[model samples]
Target: MGERPEGPGQGGAEDGTAWSGRAGAQAFAAVDAATDRLLGYPFVFRELSRRIGAGEVLVDYGCGPGKVADEAARRLGARVLGVDTSPEMLALARGSATAVAEYHLVENGRASGLADGCADAVMCNHVLASLPAEEAVLEVFTEIRRLLRPDAPFVLLSTDPACSGTEYASLRIGDPGEVYGPGDELTVRLRRTDGSWQEARNHAWPVGVLPALLERAGFRDVVQHRPTVEEALTVADAGFATGRAWSAERARPPLVITTALATPAPLT
Candidate 1:
């Protein structure tokens, strides 16, 4: 992928930098509520939850607020570690996650302070777009590769080309930000609760091109999820239709990506 959109703590959202102090709080409340409903899809957790061994330590990569981590902890019986960049988001995540998860706030999404080969699994849900540079996403990928056991899995779900501008329009939610190539990054500007705009550049990738990236990241048994907007809508309420229209566009269905077993390949 090209460069990612800006990340949580970087760019215009610098420390001591406030987007919409009260605005972020309110919006995240709604975001967390919506995420609760969205996690119900079978494609969300069935395989990872069912397949991994009991008591495995899984990293909920880019765990914005640990919603998916909470789900994984609830069903898989696996211990979860939720990671993200926004302290406010992390604090909220700490509150929402079950006691089963070990919560943490990373200074950057590209780095999780865990030791090498420690994690059994890593999941990045809509996290790619959280950072503006492809380097950031790639760095996060490299970190996941480093921390997970050689044979572990790293599941990544990112924006499908058709739906990238639209689904992300939530932060902007409706605005079609600039589109660059896979290797490019998009810095998005959106309104916080207070009616002001903040920018975070996250990386977007076409659903079709994830495999090559995964391969380079040292992941195997890589899988891709190309759910149609109609299917995604069935899983969500009418309220999310606008939130997810990018998936509905034909010729480029925004996919829900899933990768497995981060088993390391031999060095060439």
Candidate 2:
């Protein structure tokens, strides 16, 4: 399991967990997150925008340094709450001029100080990769469910582990033909804004198994969508959509967005 909730490399035994200290936090804040920027987060915001309107509460679970949360707040006008297990990350997040409405710490496997069912919607982006077991993932889903009101939407943004070896703009998941089962370790390479690559050790959770897990965690209506470049042409920024050849991504889109609704609470 990952030491703290944030993006990959928050700290672990794999190679070197570079996402520590002020420098590491700054470096993480600077990651290009190319695949995410193009195909991952835009789709998440779109999904949230459809479900909730401006001023509603959106909890960004495992929000690393508040970049994506800030964007969601700015784009959708939601009161974004960023929660992470890492105090360092939360500090970095709070330091951002464009930080979200609030930053909260997650302690002892829960988002401390945030009330139950406080969110209108919740989005967990790439945080599951750090989990190494079904129970861990289920725990995350359960917590997310606890954060939502009855029937609130939970949008999970993840990378498809099967799309390995293919180099998209900024990410390469694993070795070619390397089929990864749930909880299998894999090396993911991410590009920085300055054009350098960094490796992170993460675990795989295939899209097929997520629905069942969500069901077991008190969620319903699980639907998964893989965003493609063709779709991005409509949803993404004009310049970004037409920016690159995006040949690899066009052929095999690695990003997956799983949307589910929290089941209503049982009667007392």
Candidate 3:
């Protein structure tokens, strides 16, 4: 954690004490509203949902009011759990979600509330970068391994480090850039639904080094897939530039959503 937080902080456009009170609930609801549309949301919920392999349980790590979890449950027919540190965000998630958790995780971004060998898929969309530089990412990976039923797929969506720092900082909140580096203790300034801005320090990590981490975490069948901004829009019923709502909004963002799978290694 000594070095600069890698890359810029990015998120799904949510951040702050969102799970704490009325304000948090409103904040989360706004994020949902943006993604609720066919054009303006972040992440690929439908594609991610369709790809899950007969999942009994799914974990939406850094769930941010649980929109992704709700989408996963609705599409995958899997029992899903959404985890986030904000109470307001949790309430919003609970209202929209049909998952099993009656509560939310208020711990640091790297930790989660679910148990070991529990879920079949873990959707970490726009999540890992919110951790303290590097410490929390590994813990989260370990958590995924422990909660997964072996060879569980970790579907990750994060900002491409190839994207410029200034560009990364431009997203509103819940976007990784806004949540930058967990322990760099870098403060993030975010705008709320009420038209106010708040700041919190976060973590940032690039998309490039993840393969090595997956191998170290005992996940086999680890592979990388880079889908373009155009590809995501076409798949989510959103516009890519001018035609779909999703594509029109996210045409050129550095955001990258990749699907990676890991299986428990066979006994020697």
Candidate 4:
């Protein structure tokens, strides 16, 4: 769900950061829907839903077409707010608005319009890795921290830093002669629903770096979760297994799902 496909046009903030443009946004919306369906509809969101109770406010950071936001509102009965950088994507999200779900534009991860401590929980799915710089990622984390109440949960789903030479149903990484080390840059090729390919750039930070980053952003009790092959096979739709051979051949897990608690503020 975090993957983006480049198209004819690209747009961004005044700083010239590149987000999906009109054409790219349309393609990305389709890709996101297909990817979610193939992966059984935002498994990470479902997992996060299990942890929070009804009526809690959930913020979907970088919510791309509102798929996860819609699901969160429908299934968990939570009031959901989605924030994204792309106006085109935000339009798509708003087009399918639910009574409990709303979206706003966030330029460079600055949600100035949203009041402080407004979210009970925050979910950022694959957004950090899409950023072009580490500073941007940090800024987004700080923004998420700003939005959450003290001790609220911040759930993140992203590509596994330790993964190398892995192939999923719709993704491929670590080609021959490719190197991915700590802080190195890597490219992921994703298959779109239309049987086309889209490339997304990512940074290869070690698995240890994420928790430290979260701590610096005032998040505590960070816990990392990796999916087992059995879990993946089980959670996937029934059609995941077919005439093709079942192979769990991968150097490491393809995705990293982590939960961190926001550190409570000190009393004045």
Candidate 5:
């Protein structure tokens, strides 16, 4: 596939560096995110809608540029909060015409100004790909646990690194038949709205390890779903599902949604 390579730290693995500068933020904002649009986000929203009521709080953890957060607020009528570690991304989000209720900067691995248990649910989409290690992944999950009330759901959306090499409608992960272990580096080529492709260096966290990490982070009832095209037709936005034929996506679904409930507070 024809794609362009972004400059250093544009989408590289570094604290506040991935999607760092104004250029990086804008570039990320322009990502087509076909997998997310077709399968990942729709399933997350549906899971959230079943658990939380309108006006309830939903935190969009790792909300780069706030696109999905804004969409969630509008679609679910929820008070959506967009939180990210990158100030540039937050600045870009604030400048956009978005429905996100609030934007907070993540300082010292904690979301500033958001109270503990403030959200009814939280959805972290594609954020795991940027983490460099399992420890970082655990930290993210632990922070999300802190933001949710007991038993509130935490929904995480990520790509299956094992499905590498296949060119999907919007992105391709690594080379064909390439195998990646946890924390291994991989190249992700993402399509933009302008029909251009750009490459980002991302880490692979195998789907198999997520359940144990969630369990350690004060969560329970962990469940995983690999969304299929047939499922997307029913749950995804009609515009996305019908936009084009998802032949590659239909053959091997690459996205995985892992949901877990925050463990209830201990008895007094």
Candidate 6:
């Protein structure tokens, strides 16, 4: 995921900047909704809801249009705080507000204004890869740790660096004209429902590198999840049945879902 631009209606990066790009925002907003229905939202949300539980405070870092936050609030009975850098995106999120979810704007590269230890669980969905630098990603992780109580969960979802743009089950890379090398920043074009195209920029980080970064950010017991065909079939909605078949033959997973525990404080 890349940062959104500061100007109005321009899609830029997700590094705590406003996504003012109308087309980008609109495309992503649609993607956010489709993700809930077509992708693995039911499974992911179920896992998150179980881990975070009802009555827990969940901080959705880079919440975009607040789709996940709203869903968590409605389905799992959790209180969700959605933080994003894009005012345009936040505007959309606020427009669809539910009683259990709130939206806030955050500064680029910082999670300031949020109180320490205010969250029981932190989830960064497709947001970490948007960070241009490793330091920025680390800062976000550190901030997540700051916002969480000891041993709280930090869940992350990102594009699998191991899988090529053409290899994913549901996602298709279109008109990019080039393959991304390791750790390269690349622009991805996604086809929209109306036969239009939307673009997003992402950094390619290998799966092996993420756990070390989490550990350095003071998280422990890192675990990775690669949903299998059986798992996908069980949790996927009818609309995503074809995607499960596509995933069955793939050698690498399409998405990387990782979880880590915030390390406990040492007793004085």
Q: Which candidate is the best by TM-score?
A: 2
Per-residue lDDT tens digits for candidate 4, residues 1-268, read 2333221122222222344666656656655233323333346666667777788888888777676678778877888888877777778778865644677778655764788789989887767555545676677788889898998888887665455556665656546456566547666666667776666555565556789888878889999876654564566555653323435322344666778988896122
lDDT by residue (tens digit), candidate 5, 149-176: 9999988888889999999998898889
lDDT of 1 by residue, 1-268 (tens): 1111223323224221322243443343333223223332334555566557778997776565455677778777888887766666667667777644676656544444677787887766665554545566556777778778888777665554444455332343213755556645454444444545555444555556667666676667777665555654655455764464352243344446566566564223
lDDT of 3 by residue, 1-268 (tens): 0001111123223443222365544443443233223322234555455656444677766666555566667667777776666655666667766664544463653344566667777776655545654556766666666667766677766644343333122233234444333333334344344655444344445566777776666576655545544554565554423343443235445555556565564122
State residue 51's C-alpha deviation in candidate 3, in Å.
4.1
Model 6 lDDT at residue 224: 83
Off by over 4 Å in 5: 1-17, 266-268
Candidate 3 Cα errors over 4 Å, as ranges: 1-22, 32-55, 99-113, 165-201, 238-252, 263-268
Report lDDT (CA) for all predictions. Answer: 0.55, 0.81, 0.51, 0.64, 0.81, 0.62
Ranking by TM-score: 2, 5, 4, 6, 1, 3
Model 2 TM-score on a 0 to 1 scale: 0.93
- The deviation in Å at residue 264 for candidate 4 is 0.3
Task: Report the C-alpha displacement of residue 212, candidate 5, in angstroms.
Answer: 0.3
How far does residue 260 in candidate 3 sit from its true spot (Å)? 3.0
Q: lDDT for model 2, on a 0 to 1 scale?
A: 0.81
Q: Model 4 Cα displacement at 127 (Å)?
A: 1.0
Kindly report the root-mean-square deviation of model 2 from the true structure over all alpha carbons.
2.8
lDDT of 5: 0.81
Clashes of each: 39, 0, 46, 0, 0, 16
Q: Total clashes, candidate 4?
A: 0
State TM-scores per candidate: 0.69, 0.93, 0.67, 0.82, 0.92, 0.81
